[model samples]
Target: MANTPSAKKAARKIARRTLINKTRRSRVRTFLRKVEEAILSGDHEAARAAFKVAEPELARAAAKGVIHKNTASRKISRLSSRVKAVGAA
Candidate 1:
């Protein structure tokens, strides 16, 4: 529990930031899901397109501090690999 006025205000700010971060994280997940679906469905073109859209969303999320930069880069790398393999297959 926050006792001082400043502490209470800080708590409120944390709560607000939590909600915003949750939404940002959820948005990133939604984009990732789209890419995964496209990949799973074996549509290379769609997968590539979805990846195109998802890549920037991931980068933006990392930039906004919703996710770590390395995490975003790793996900992008893995997805790009899968997309390339899909094309090869």
Candidate 2:
């Protein structure tokens, strides 16, 4: 389909960007999952640590255009509240 040289090059660039974005998204998910797991296990300290790690990853992903800024902010706020609740308990 991409017969022209420019088109072909564009396709290749798209493929490379897709792979990089996928990796970044996956890394962000992994960090979030760690926080969730720690929260579920009721380990406040671990949850806090995971939140510390995940917050930056989420912010970076948003900054890089991998996700929306508000979405990232909402996630961080909710997770922080949950972590606080765990600590209070």
Candidate 3:
């Protein structure tokens, strides 16, 4: 429970921020899923295109603090490798 007025306001702010962050996270996941689906379906061009879109989304989410910087980097690295392999195959 928030006792002070300031605390109550902060709680409200936090709730709003939480919703925004959740939205951002979901958007990022959707983009990643698109890439994964393209990869699994063996569409190299689609996968590469999805990755291109997802990379910037992931970077933006990280920049906004929705996810960790290292986490975003790791995902980008792994996905890039998989996308490259798809192209090679």
> How much does each candidate deviate from the true structure in C-alpha RMSD?
0.6, 0.7, 0.4
In model 1, the runs with Cα more than 4 Å from the true position are none
Question: Which stretches of candidate 3 lie above 4 Å from their native place?
Answer: none
lDDT (10s digit) by residue, model 3, range 3-86: 999999999999999999999999999999999999999889999999999999999999999999999999999999999999
Instruction: Give the candidate order by descending TM-score.
Output: 3, 1, 2
Q: Model-by-model lDDT, in order?
A: 0.96, 0.97, 0.98
Q: What TM-score does candidate 1 reach? A: 0.97
TM-score of 2: 0.96
Per-residue error at 15 for model 2, in Å? 0.3
Candidate 2 residue lDDT tens string, 43-83: 99999999999999999999999999999999999999999
Clashes of each: 0, 0, 0
Q: TM-score of the candidate numbered 3?
A: 0.99
- Model 3, residue 47: distance off in Å is 0.5
Rank by lDDT, descending? 3, 2, 1
lDDT of 3: 0.98
The local distance difference test score of model 2 is 0.97
Q: Against the true structure, what is each candidate's TM-score?
A: 0.97, 0.96, 0.99
lDDT of 1: 0.96
Leading candidate by lDDT? 3
